[model samples]
Each structure stands twice: as C-alpha cells, then as structure tokens.
Target chain A: MASARLPNLGAGNYFGLGELYAAWKNPEIQEMALHTSLSALGYVDILRVPAPILEEHVFPFMETPTSTTMEIAGTPVADDALMEWAVEERFVNATRVMVIDLDRCVRCDDCVRACASTHGGNPRFRRHGRTFDSMMVANACMHCADPVCMIGCPTGAIHRSVEHGTVIINDITCIGCATCANSCPYNNISMVAIRNPDGATITDPDSGKPIFKATKCDFCDGQPGGPACVRACPHDALKRVHFQELNPAGMAT
Target chain B: MIRRSALPFIVIGIATFAVVAWYARFTWLELGNPSIVTGYTLLVLMLMLGFFNIRKRLSMVPVGRTSLLLAFHVAAGLLAIALFWLHTGTLWPTGSYERILAVLFYLVSLTGILGYIILRSLPRRLTQTGIEVVYERIPAELGEIREKVEALTLECTEKTGSDTVAQHYIGTLNWFFRRPRFGLSHLVGGDAAGHWLRGPGGAARRYLNDVEKEYFDQILELGTLKILVDRHYACQDLMKKWLLVHVPLSMAVILVSIWHLLLVNVYAI
Candidate 1:
C-alpha cells in the first residue's frame, strides 16, 4: 500500500505565524505537561501513554496504543502506526447509491409513471424527469458524503445514518419548513403535498391548511424488495450504485 | 453581500430562463403565458438557490441537499420536456431548436450523473492526517527545565568520576523527578538530544553544549507537531470544497433540464 504523506514541518514548513503563536498559547499544552509529570510518577490514564503526549496527539491517533507490532514490507511496526497508515490518505469516503442505465431505458415512462402513480399525480416525484430533448433523472436523495441538506435542517430531521451511511429524513422530526429543499444541491428532495393513505389531502389540524412534508425515494428501506423505483421498473433501467463495485481500487471500494 | 460564490446561482438562473424562453419559441407551449412563465421562473429560482447551497459550503444543510436538488431539477426538466412534447405531439421532429435542446438536456443529465459519482468517491482518497507525536504535551519552558535536569545529571556524573549505584539513583531522580518529568519520552526516544548528558542547572560542564543541542531539537519537534495539525485541517477543508464543484453543477444541469423537459413534452408529435 502507498504510504500517506506525513505533514512536513521542515525546510518546506507551511504553518503561518498566527497558528504557531496560537499553539504556543494552547492551554492543553500546559495541562499535558502537568499530566506528563504525574504519569512519570506512575499514575496511568486508561491508555498507558503519558498524559501530555496523549492529549496533544489524541485527535490524530483516536485509537489506543497497542504493544502489538507487525512486519510491514519487512519492517516490524507497532499496531498504532499501521492503523494510522490505513486511514492516512483517505478521509470520509463516499459510496455510490444510485445508477441509471440510459442504454436500457425504453422510455416507456414506467419509472416516471410508477413514481407518479405512487405519489398521486405529483409527477414531481418521478425517478426520471425529462428535458426538452431527453429524459431527466430523479430520486429523493443521492446520500452524498457532504450532505449540505443536513447543514440547515432546523429540526435535525435529515441525518446521515452512521451505521448504514444512508441519509434519512425523520418525518416525525421534520417541521415541513422546506429549508432542506432550498439547500438541496440537486433539488432531488421536495416539500411534497402530503395525504392520508386513503388519498385525501392531509392538512394541519390546527391551521386547517394542507400539510406538506419533505418526501423522496428512500430506497424503500423497509420494503422487502428495496427501492420502490428499482423494484417497480419493468426495464431494470435503475439500480442503486455501490461505487465500490465500479472502482475496486478506490478508497471506498 | 453577494460573493464570487453566488455567481453560479445567477448564471444558472439566467441561462435556465433563457433556455425556457427559447424552448417556448420552438414549441406551442405558450411561451409568453403565465403558468409556463411561472414554471420557468421556478426553474431559475431552483437553479440559483441550488448553486448557492454548494458554493457557500453551507455546512448546515442536510447530507444530500445537492443530490435532492439534482433530483428536483430532473423532475422539473421532465415537466419542461412534457410541455414541449405536448406542443409537438410527436418525437423525432426535424426542428433545430428542438434537436439542440434535446441533446443539451441529455448532456446535462449525463454530466450530472458523473458529478454524483465524483462526489461519492473522492473524499476517501484525500483523508489528511498528521504525524505521530509522542511528546507534544511538554511545554517549551518545561521541556527546557527537563533539559536542565538531564544536564545537571550528566555534569554531576562527570564531576563525581565514579559510576556508583548512588550516583545512578541521584541522576535518575534528578532527571525524572525534577519539577517536570515531561521530557522523558524525548530522553527515551533519543529526541531530547544530549540535554540529559549535561546534568541539572545552568552550570556548564564539558558536555553542556550537547545538552543545549537536545533542547534545540525539542523546540523544532514541537513546531513540527503544530504544522501537522494545521495541514490536517487544511486537507479536510479542501476535500469538502472539491465536492462543491461536483455537486453544484448537478443543480445547474437540473435547471437546464426543466426547460429541456418542457420543450420536449410540448413539441413532441
């Protein structure tokens, strides 16, 4: 594996004066020093590393120091070094969630037609919306790595699940403010006009106005077959992408 | 208050509006009328807002705001195509505007797909991390103090001349049990230079210069540690911005798509 570039602080030193001065004044430095003195006297923190060094490097390491070591390219290195090496180059990796095979699309409008049917005539919810010449693609969410929508979600309704890595909007938490819609980079999500299962428009009970909730294709997580559009498409034109399969060598893969 | 970041939104807005107007001309989609004009207006609004969401790097937006906007843009695009199809009532019509718009819409959608792929896969390749520092906690002053203690030990050792058990205890206690024991890692890791060789106090022995050299290296190591922290922060920020370019363009394409969709629906025979 290619080694990650270590931050160079030598002849090519890059930090500005302001940052250096700030570090010179960091309170944590003083605290760390005191802790180091204490640890030297044999008081151990949960980790065996001395307190001061542990505190300063805690954010970077984010892991316990293991005495265990392994050979890497014929070099016997400590476990902590190997773990840091693994995540050195890549930060937050993103996985592809949806794919549209333009080659397979018959333009039968089944996906769009199915989405419209599912959403009750609001064609705004289609898997593929079109342009003057060709078809347009649609889906509620791309589940992006940098979810701009989550930035301004006032009620914290929209969130990227840490476990599955899917961005989900908690309906009960959403206030139907449309902030997510306004901030959406692709406009895939919308403040859809909501209704009861029976097809009548759901309205605010107190305000007596039609209720709107942010809605989108959730890949039909709870459904047995997965995403409604993927399952509903007769042509198999759409599939949730797992980008890892596309680029085996890429970090996410 | 508008910055360079807001430029994409404005450009996307005007371009989408113009496309809608042009599409209206080629198709009988009531180019000069109210509902169609309103729809076109919304397309511009959507495009501008979508672009801003990305360029500003609004951290508070939901995780998939860019993706959502693209999806909505696609839907709006389809409506535009549907309107155009309604006007022409047939596909494969030999009209220049119609053909150009059709191809352009396809291109935009294709680019949008590619942008999504880039956004999803890139950041993982760019995780910025700092070096492994084992003694960043030691303040410059305290580290210097520890250096003095080590220097005293070395000086005292040389003065006493005999490497006795009592001498070793005194040296170890003076070096590790001094006012601050923070620099021991530097001592163990050989990073403390020869500061420990000089023994405690400013009183210089023959090896005092070597102890000073160790103190100097400690100063350099501390600086290197800070530089790593800043670099890590910078790389993370850069990775976030890269997504801005890839994701916002999806919105612009979506805006153009609306006009494309309307024209297709109106003009298709």
Candidate 2:
C-alpha cells in the first residue's frame, strides 16, 4: 500500500529519501508547516508516541442528499431515486479509478506470463515494468483520468466505457496505427502480433494483411474476478483499489 | 486566433480525391486489384497526415479548413480500410507478407483513430476540470522562481541568521513554482485568448496584425508562465515522441501499401 502511493518511484527500501530530505529543507514545506501548526502538534505527537499503536475505526458520516434533477422527458423524477435504481448506469461516469496495491504484489511474473500466454507470444504485459517508492509496479494500463492514448485516435476506436470507466481499445474498429502506443504517458499499451487458430495467422479483412491491435489488461470485463492476472496471482498480490477511497490525501498510512 | 499555417487542409477535399485517383491508378497498375490499392493508399495517406509536422502545416490557415482536411483524412482512412477488406476479399489469407502489411496498416489506423479522439475531445474536457500543467513547465518554473526565492531566502538569512534555504526552496517550489500554465485560459478557456486579442471585432474587421497581437500576448503570457521555455525543450521531446510513432508508422504504411499492391497484381495475374 505504501509503495502503491508512489508507484512511479520504483523498487527500493530508501526510495526518494534523498528527494524527501531535500524537500524537508524547502520553503514551501516550511510554510505549509507553519500554516498547519495546530495539525502539526498532532503530527509531532505521532513522533513522540510509540510506534505500535491502536485506534478505533469510526464510520464517516455521509452528507445529506442535496437533490437536483434535470428534466429528461417532461418528468420531475427524483435524480437520486433514478440513479439508485440504475446503479450500473451510474458507474458509467465513475470518477473513482483503480490503483495497484504494491505491497502485496510479489512480482512473480505470473500476471505478465499469463497475459502473454493468453494473448499468444506477444509480450505486452509485464509483471514489474515500472515502480514507485521501492516497489515495482506491474505494467498494465492504468485507465488514466485523462488518457493520452485516446487523444490521437482518428476514429473513436479507443473510448472509456461509460459503465466501467475503463479505457478500452475497440478491437474490431482499431486500425493498428500504433498512435496510441506513442501517446500513452505510462507506456501501458502493448502491441500484439495477432494470429488465428489452426497454427496459422490471419490478415486484416480490409487490408488483406495480418491484423495487429493494441492489447492491455481490460480488467477481464466478462471473466470471473475481473482480470485473469489478478485472479491467477499466487501471492494474492493484485487488487484494484479506488484511489480516492483508499487515499483521500494521497498519503499512505 | 487560428494560425495561418493550416492552409492545406482547407483544400483537403481536392487533395483526398487526387490521392484516391493516384491510389486507384497505382494499385490497378501495380497490384491489379482496386481494393488492395485503395486500402494501402488510404493507410499511407493517413499515416502521413498523422505526422505532427504535416498536421501543423495543414492547420496553418483556417481552423475550419484544417478541420475539414482532418475530417477528410479520417474519412479516406476509413474507406481505405474497407478497400483493404475488399482487396483481400476474405478474413484470412495464406501469405506472410500480405498479412504483415495488412496487420501493420490495421494497427496504424486504429492507433491513429484513438489519437484523434484524444486530440479532439479529451483535451477540451480534461482541460476544463484540472489543468495539467506540463511536467516540463513545472521544473523550469521551479528553477526560475527558485532563483528569485533563493535571493529572498538569502535576504531573510542575512537578517535572521538562519540557514533555512532548503525550507524556503521547498516552500516556494510547491506553492509558487507549480502553477497552471494557462490559468486564465483554463478558467475562461480556449477562445479567451482569441477574445482578448480580437478585441470587440468578432472577426468582422480583424486583421492579420490583430491575430499576430493575440498570438504575441499568448506567446508572452506563455513566456511569463515559463511555458514557452519548458515547451522549447518539450516541443523536441513531443516531436520525437510523435516521430517515433508517426514517421515509422507512415513508412510501414507505405511498405505494406507496396506489398499490398504487388500481391494484388500477382493474385489477379
């Protein structure tokens, strides 16, 4: 979990310690410290307090519903009621995206190997491609908030699923230009050499040539437990987390 | 104001038709198959246009005209995909070169399409919510502001007898250094620069000078925000990045196109 908070940092025990030390001497940190003086006292207490600590978990209170409705079809329908009834549809616009729980990840290469095996010999998936805070992040599409890959697609071949909010590369529509491969910030998209069964490969229906498409972890939309890699992990290392729910302030406790 | 360089896309319709004609002739002559020729031709053109330099050149004149070119680029590419299918006349084939070319073209087109969506739609929506100041800009701004902030720290140090340089650096970098590249633009968004530059003209009596002045303000603001400095290096990185994708993909498109042509010729013969 701690590693997950800083996935870009890569694997190492003293990850970013040098940078952190530098930050400690920074004026912005000092200013922020001075402003949060009251909160600082509690933070100071944490240093003074013993490491092994116990705390009671309290359920947070939910804010009261402030209801508003858009007139869809000459109806003054309750928005909340309609939304509650259509929970799946509401998930279509979900802002809560997934995160990699790095601590539990063993990096055994099962996910990577499984992805390759499932998708033929193409090595589009990685068990530990990138990292954050001394933890290696297994390479998979992050399904980013603002996906860069979606930008350059001339056709709407790549789109976010309204239901899952997952970035998808529509296979049939995809023209295999490798534009998304270049645009991806995380380098998550993998190009695959697609083949057909019967020990033979196929050609693009249109171009009369082999069909290649960008493939990545689709979170196993119809498969059991979502993703095959996650499900197949022997170490139980993989789990999708809602970043907002997990880390409100982006700090690992 | 839309820059003047996007002129070619204005006549994209004519260019596209001409390219198609050229493609049809070349394909029939070389491949002896219309569909194969069309598919490969479309792929080559799409990949070429996908190049940032080419796109920039096309977008020089009128934004609308450039947009029309972009639309044609997209349409021709799609039609070419159909032509590819028609050229093959089947889903599966028994040739390696034939399949490789087709596959490469497919991937290139698909990725290009995805890129278009991100360029056209995603940026507008995402730019509205939380402006993603380029990472390059963040560091440069930090450095520039770092100089000023460090000087301020030195002044404070002289007075207070405390070496809090580190503290000050962090403080200023986080608070002041990392800022939206275009705060006002993000707030009012897109046409705000145009509005500011165009003044009250609303495109009626606007001159090239007016457009240039608007661009000047934009460039000046970008400089002030240190965006230009960041982008100076960043432009190279961006260009390289796109080149890695666009240029090679274009080459692949052309290669596959030639192969597709020859294969169709042999098949017909």
Candidate 3:
C-alpha cells in the first residue's frame, strides 16, 4: 500500500494545496484533476466517461460532493498482479539480484569491466544466468538467505558479512577446498588459483604447491555508493535490485 | 513459508488416507482392488518427480519457484512411498515379476531418500573442511601438485648431494602423487594419508642434510595439498555418484511401473 507522490499533471494543472482554491472554482479544471487522479490510480477504464454521464451525473455531483476534496477511488495504485508474478517468478526470494533488461542492455561489457576493475582486474560475476523475457538474473551471488554454499566450509572461512549480509570468503583461513564452489547451486562462486602481485602462483614456501581460493561477488560492500557494475552501466540496463522490490512492469520492455 | 504452503498438501494426503481407511472398514469394496487409485496417484507423483530435472533445465522460463517445486517434490515423494506401502498391503510380493517391480520401487525410494540425506548432510561436512574445490578440476589441480612436488624433490637431491629423500619419494610417494589415491579413505573422512605422511614420510627427514630438510618440508606441504585434493575428489565424487543411482533407478521404476499398469489392465482386470 505504498503511495507515490503525484507529479505535476501538466502545465498550470497544479493539484497542490496552493492551487486547491483555483482547481475547486473551475469545473473544467476539476474534471481534468479527477481524470488525472484516476489515471494515476491505474483506473484508466473509468476515464472513458460517456458524454451524457459526465455532463449530467458526474459534473453536477462534483459541487455537492465537494470538489475541494478529490477522493479518487479505485483499486490501490500498487500492482498486486505484478508483485504476485514477481514472487511466483522467484524474484522476491533472491537477496541481491543483478537483473539486466535485455531490451535496454546493448550487450556492452562495461559492467564486466567495472566489476574487473573494482576487484583487481578479476570480474566477480559472469554475464549470464536464468532469464525471464528480457530480464536476466546474472550470475552474481544473491547472498541467499539460505546459502547452501555455507554448509561445508571446514575452516568457517566462507561466511556472511556482519554489517552488509554479503557472503564473503576469508582468504587467510580458506583452505582452497572448492567445497563452496561445488555447493553453490547457481555456480556463482568461482575457485581462483591464488597468485602473488607479480602474477606468480602463490604457493606454500615449503611445498611450492599452488594455492586456490573461492571468489564471488561481494556486492561491492566497501565501495562508495555501492556496486560498481550497477554504477557503471551507462544505459541504466543493469541494476542490483532486491528481489522483493523487483517491479515486473518495469521489466516488460 | 515452506511449512505454510505444505499445509494444504499435508491435509490432502491425510484426507486421502482417511477416505481409503473408511472405505476399507465399512464399504463392500475390496482393499486389494483399491490399487488402481493409489497406483495412478503414485504414477502421477513419479512423473512429477521426473519433471524436476526438466524444471532445473528450464530455469529461464517462469514456471514457478524451484525451491517450492523441490519442497513439493520431496513431500510428494514421501507420500508416494506411503501410497506404495498401502497399494501392496504387504512388504514382499509373491510373484516373480511383481517382486522385480517391488524391488525396483524399493530401490528407487531408498536411493531417493539416501540422496536427500546426503544432499542435506554433505554440505555441512564439506564446510567443515576450509578448502573449496571444483569437482571436475581436481585432476588438473592434483597434477600441478605432483609436478611441484617432483621439482622440489629434484632440487633437494641436487643441492644437498643426497638421494635419501629422493629415493624415499620414488619408493613411497611417486605413484601416490601421480594421481588421486586413498579415495575410499577420503570418502569416509579417514586421514590415513596425513598419518602416513607425518609418520613414515617424515622419517625421511632425519636422513636429510639442512638444505634437503628444507626441501623435505616443502614435499610434506605438497603432500598435505594432495590430501586436500583427494578429500575433494572423494566428497564431490560421492555427491555426483549418488545421482547415478537415484536417476536411473527412478527411470527403471517408471518403466517397470508402466509395464505393471499394462498387465493389470490387460490381464488382471
């Protein structure tokens, strides 16, 4: 039942308290206000007023009913159908869903580059995953509420971030077991062989055996203003939306 | 949310049982002849269970929540087991062909239950080990470790002018490092490799000079890495192998079940 503040209807069609008296005085303006309010409430069908009904039943009753108070009545503005569809689509269950509007997305790799640059030239997420219509929920950690990936970390290295709730692997303690990588049902986590700054494989000094660690999108936890991929999408095609907040209507291209 | 959604299904299952019980107690209808209804229900449940793989493959299509589907699949599978018990009305079948069907059915159910248990438990066991690995890449990773170990052993022999450590590695660790070993031990969470490395493998260290001892330490570290790799293979392999049992048996159950249905309709009727 979240209400949206109505934007200005048109030039000189102010519906605020400042212009309330003027809107009340003019019948044509009041009718326009009624139409706009109804439209805003998604009652477009009601606006198809027959000429006789509008002039006789509706307009005459306006003064009696008090045009000063425009009580627009219809279904609530919230799209319950869209919300239900999103939930049915499993969008609401995802923690941090990186959705791409395929229509808007030009298949440009800017988001990929942004992710790579943020994470020392290694992108944390892949560009593909399950898609519904034009919207693709890319291969990024949803930081699932029930992360199966956390089930078998012997060292307790892979854990949820206390502040942000992001699933992060503690590199120092991670034994490079790849249990988490295999456990991730979505294949979001990737096991990368550890390397020194100079690109030499980081290995035990004693054994000289190469090391590996599980890596995935951390939702750009410490980055100012949030995920670099979302920020870097020039066309606004990519967004990190909570599944619950996903608007199915917005994704309809 | 799962519990809430499952309530209706549970209620329906109870209703089905109650109806069957009432019919058996009071009605002239025979309980043995009630197999058609229950059998059909079981068949439908099996078909639903089979569709789970299809659902997984069609993730892009907006069918429904996979978690919700999985919950239904689990519940339906259990209910199907109950229906199976009721349909047969006995643990063992008398006829040979009937026995085969029952055996396949039981095997399918047993494997399904075992797979579910493993799915629930193995993740926790995997997390207990700090190392994470991709199952398919284990061989390549193991190869890298073997190469590193071999290089370390060769360097130790060259620097210290001794083949004691090198000779010991050749005799004891050569084949071990070449490929994944102690698979069954790793599967059952045994640390026999670690024990051998520390005990017999560490025995080679005493014979080595200071420089070779350093290399010995490196070889021990490589051995530890190999053990981790072995453990990964064990757990991952089991996880993958469980499906081989579960899926094919499920298919066999369905195939034998259809044959049972045809026989029941054509002759038994």
lDDT digits (tens) for residues B48-143 of candidate 3: 888876655443344555545656667777777887887788899898998999999889888878766655545445545545555667888998
lDDT of 1 by residue, A144-253 (tens): 65667788888898887666677777889999998888887567788876878797988888999998888765544343434445544433445555432322122113
Per-residue C-alpha lDDT of model 1 across residues B1-269, encoded as one tens digit per residue: 22233345445545655675576665545544434544455456446535533522332222332333444444444444444443444555476765664565445545544443433332222222213111232245445544654565465446655333224435453443333323333312232323433333222222334544454344334333433333323333333344455455555456565766577469742
Q: In model 1 chain B, which range of ten residues has the least summed lDDT?
A: B125-134
Whole-model Cα lDDT of every candidate shown, in order? 0.45, 0.46, 0.71
lDDT of residue A183 for candidate 1: 81
lDDT of 2 by residue, B32-116 (tens): 6566555655556555455433533332122232333445555556555555555566765568876777677777777666544
Model 3, CA-based lDDT? 0.71
Off by over 4 Å in 3: A1-253, B1-16, B19-32
CAPRI band for model 2: incorrect
RMSD of 3: 20.6
